[model samples]
Target: MTSPDQPNPEAVSDETLFGADVADYARYRPGLPDAAIHLLAATQHGVPDPVLLDLGTGTGQVPRALLPVLRRLVHIDLVDVHQHMLEAARAALEPVRGSCTVSAFTGEAHTFTPAMPGLAPTLITSCRSFHWMSRPRVLAMADRVAAPHAVVAIMGDGSLWTHEADWTATLRRLIQTYLGDDRRAGTRGTYAGPGRPYEDDLADSAFSDVSEHCFPVARAWTPEDVLGYLRTTSFARPALFADRYREFEAEALGLLKAHARGGVLKEDAEFTVLLARRPGGAA
Candidate 1:
């Protein structure tokens, strides 16, 4: 998953900050929990084949997870600012093309223009990537492009850096020692927490009928898997450390190995989904 933090106050481009890590991201990031998909599907029960527009669809994790459950979906549009990430998402969704029309767009979440006319999405989703967006702008864009009564879902779980497991805490300490206490993102900036909760943003937008759901997920990680996951995160992308990348890896692995229990570290995360829809009925 890409870091939700804006690269810097200077406004670095998402492609420059995250494109290089697309491969690792596609390989190692966790897919959305089944409950999230179920909730989304439930919201569309009576609708016919619907169009799904996923913004910041890094490697298509959200679409891929929903594919099996959203069998009736007629079209899926994946949008991202990074071409590499878009390419990866297209590749991941290729197998499902026989079931639905799948297309990709390279642009910001708030500014994407669908290629076809009358392509208003019936469901819009931004997983993990919502934090990187101009929330109000994106919501305004959603209001413009979404079908009436369309559900806009924003989902995320805390990253490994924030996990509370002993091994994870130790690992985080090691990262802080090398990268410093503030969470480093991209090349030169630290992550800034959102000033307000996403619920507030949705409550104030056109999609004001808002609800939230959380799913409990237990994850077991081997030292190697943990390291691979690190490669995909904003806080530990190799480019952020440059020449010291290998050295940092070696030290981090050693620390992880020391803390692992039976070659695995366990963490429990609450995957939260916030669902919003316009007050009026579907158009």
Candidate 2:
């Protein structure tokens, strides 16, 4: 039975959930030095080597990218709602084992409580993962869980293909050429994309005494890379489709190849990062 307030699990599977596509997400995905890095730079003025907490850390990209830059950070707590996503993050961070200590766990954002002793962190960040959380619940958790000077940065509401024209038309044309117009309700629109707007509830609220900014990042994707990425999308899964899977795949590849620059499709993706600091704790 579906509850009025809760997400419909039957309508969505964890494999197809927000945590999916984490493997190729960091590899083929563009827009690094994303909102999280910007937030770290802003609050890093006086803080040296402060403990870091990464919420909704998919494939450990944010921490892995930011680890080299922090002056004095020793440990990172990577939290996620899905165990599999955390596992992927663990694997990605293994090559850089000596850089920083990492503790990964699976738990709901609302009920999550750090078990680490004396673990009040100086920085807490979420990259492209904040939208799944309920705003009020997350705010309450932030208020209680963070150290006084903790910085919370949530990045989302950014688009991967940000062409000025109706890119949706291009996307639809590609999908139709492959799938032949037989679309599932879940896979029909922009909602099926890997990116989404963050926290519709907090859409109206602005952070006080916190600086928020958006940075533009671009990446060039070959036909193969784009296909690999699209395959990671929720709609591209086997279970999600009733038929025409390979036909769709081939067509998608062919369509993008037609428009690819130098036989590559360059996607313009943008990420919105939210950086907020608690009053008085650590620098």
Candidate 3:
């Protein structure tokens, strides 16, 4: 499901749509569950020093979370269209990358080529950013770069705007009052849902053998935390509100405070990962 904050796939460039919020995103966006990383690493069990290709690797959250666990992971190719996001990801991964070599590529995911020779990825990951890409094209490109047993993992969870909670409803209503009924993605237009399921797209791609996994996550947010998270999202980005941005913040803070129990808000969400591989492979 598309949220008010999710960018319209047709409206703008990836950098313009997401780069403006890079700092906030790096600070507030949730990391992948440890169990999910374990599941991803388990797929590459016997492979010695496997390579990882992470598409749409915003701030390198997936790599940062997976590097500590996947001792066999030897190299990582972080691909993104935004230079700032690529730099942020490189910085985040460098300090912790013990035996692994991390490299960043500033370009669209579908067209990215690995910088290192003979680098066929054993595991390819896209977290919370696959929706921005052309699935078939990316899968075709992956086919050219992936090893025989490579697994393509697509993972995401709903955003704060899509979460069902009393405080969220109230906050959404306030946004609607100011931004109108339509969910404003940027200055250009509103969001349109991806018409079909991602599974359907993957089913039609080269990576047709698919398996799914889900992790239940419980989160606690302070009023300040919620505000900080909003700053990272497309719907409530400060630049989108312009002159009324501070006004919206004041009212939103008041609403959050009214609903908070000891300045804390609670949410229950499910993080899902879909792992796909070529038919007859051991993904």
Candidate 4:
């Protein structure tokens, strides 16, 4: 969902963005921190028949992370534009399914409504995928789909590129050397970044009451892990490098190896979650 947005954008289209990187994304992308997971599940603490609708359900990461902790979560509806990613999500969640049922939709998050009537979500979540969607529209949709006490949780930590570290700086330079001065966005040219703070977006929507949570997350990455992660990023995906992608990868690996201590690279990040609710809403 880090890809650049074109005019009249929906969720980042699979064919242009992560069509070939879905496997790498599922394998290498870190799960939400345990503290974050507990907090999400805690929001549904008193609700009856809690349902979770993950708006930009990339490979079902948010739901997968929440399901194990949320025994009360009876149903999960995942929405993403990419069928391939949805297929991957469906397959991954199959082994974990117990009493709960999972359904996936391939379309804009703003347009999704549960097929079963009177089935509003107890919690609505948009993780890393929120920035790619039309923010205001999605929030308005959430207002309609969410129960009176439900909260719309927007969660993400900045990617590796945003991390301020020696290793990340070197990696960025390497990517710039092969690509260009700007971040390479899939199909849509350079990334312009999400201009407005997501907090502002929430304030402007129906969900005006917002609470923020910050979690300290420390991650260790091997050179191999870093390589796998780069494959999932729009800034360094193979498609952006043309025929020289192999050359770029070789150089990138060498640089990463040089930086690794005990064959490990460290990333410390602040993961933020904004839990938004309507005025006087409880959750």
Candidate 5:
């Protein structure tokens, strides 16, 4: 392990950050809580024909969750830096696409523009992903392509690393034992989160009119589920462990089992959604 004075490892290029974890991610990462999903649909109410631009759309969770309830949604554009993620997103959303057009773009969210120009979206979303982007640049792009009444919804509940429970605390300690004390991030670096809250970022951006919502969610996990979720995390993914990932997995499973109560581990999470709109009386 590097000394405290040592610099953090250089991060992998953003495009490749989550590429290797797609399968486990698709299989195990929790979807947006249903309350949040319904609220997102309501955000588009009264719009003539709503369309969606889901930035950093990991496996298209935002769209997949909204499609069933947001029936009038006419189109969806899924953008991500990783093509692997976009591919999996496409597969997951196809059966539910209905008459709406679903398109995937493999590129940075800040640089994405519609293949069909002049088609502004009524709803824009980024879930658990805005931090991985050039935040100001993305909001600027969203400004150029959004309908005046469109809402930019940034949503996330903190991951397992932030969850506070006796079991999760134990799990974090075990992870630190294998990795390091500083949070491991992506493939090559430690996580240094945004300096200020996302609220501060929005306050300075085009979408200065903002509101926040929180949905309390309760989730239960099995030891196997915990292992599968760990495989998709930047901190504990198999690559981070090198040759010892199998050992880590075995040990992690045992540790989790010992902590489980009646075959379950619990998470009490609050999912937060920040809805931003242009600073005007459009709505």
Candidate 6:
């Protein structure tokens, strides 16, 4: 639904830009976060030797997975606007000892550049983080730093409900149990809260012009995993709420118990990969 001309409002905040739920995020969503390594495996050559750059690289996940494959993963510059996230990435990457050149910096996606000084990257990868970028600016930036024959791969949750079919019902029961007094507001609304909404591409813009593909990845969780996943979510943070999260967690757990089959919640979800190349850049 987003257009090239409209700036996605969600691009502005630093939700977990700080180191808030980084550990939880790394735990539950480890699969998707680590999926960037495989992205390079899908290159035209079927195995890539391209110079890489990772935008919004959280906890150094991409670099950790990719360093082994590339001939020389030179000048890996990870840019994140959050200082805390960068700190976590630094810590995670510090133990790495190899020929790869790794560096972390604090900057927005648009301001990020390869560390190789005037070099354009042959491959660029972003995972589950582009929904927060300004569409027009990002596409223009991609067109700039991406080498003539470069490839960019972007992954996102095309449909969060792709897995959790009955989240609404679960949510309803949870609200009824936790907020016993006023069930309506707690269930239908305020789960994700106002500005922090969970959906995809409010505007269908130039970036959507790329060749797109989707595949189902792992999306199974017990009540505990679900709780861990929520802790990593932008919505589940204490700063975003007026009330203590215990009430919210109790309500959420109630919903899961009410709708869960055999006390477990399963959802059909997949990862969407959008691979684009500059028209004349590569064959």
Q: Rate the local accuracy (lDDT) of all candidates.
A: 0.82, 0.60, 0.83, 0.84, 0.84, 0.57
Candidate 5 has an lDDT of 0.84
Give the per-residue lDDT of model 4 (tens digit) for 1-283. Answer: 1111112244445565776868898999898999998999988888989988898787888888887889777888878888778778877777775777777777788877675446688899988878888899998888887888988899999898889999999999899998889988887688878899999999999899999999999999999999999898778888889899999999999999999999999999999999998899875
Off by over 4 Å in 2: 1-13, 18-22, 34-39, 97-99, 160-168, 176-207, 279-283
In model 2, what lDDT does residue 16 have?
55
Better of 1 and 4 by TM-score: 4
Best by TM-score, which number? 4
By lDDT, highest first, what's the ranking?
4, 5, 3, 1, 2, 6
TM-score of decoy 5: 0.93
For lDDT, candidate 5 versus 6, the one ahead is 5
Runs in model 3 deviating more than 4 A are 1-15
Report lDDT (Cα) of residue 47, candidate 3.
88
Backbone atom clashes (below 3 Å) for every candidate: 0, 2, 1, 0, 0, 13
RMSD of each: 4.7, 6.7, 5.7, 4.5, 7.4, 7.7
Give the C-alpha lDDT of model 3: 0.83
Clash pairs for candidate 2:
49-72, 49-73
- Backbone clashes counted, model 6: 13
Estimate, for each residue in 1-283, the C-alpha lDDT of model 2 and write its tens digit.
Answer: 1111122232222555544566666665554654547467657567655777777776777777776666366677777766667778777766664656677656656555665647676777776666455566766776677776677777764432334433335755666554456433234342443344343333433323455577665667687776666555543443344577676677667767777768866655555676665444343
Task: Give the true-structure RMSD of model 6.
Answer: 7.7
Better of 2 and 5 by TM-score: 5
TM-score of predicted model 6?
0.73
lDDT of 4: 0.84
Q: Show the lowest summed lDDT stretch of 10 residues, model 2.
A: 1-10
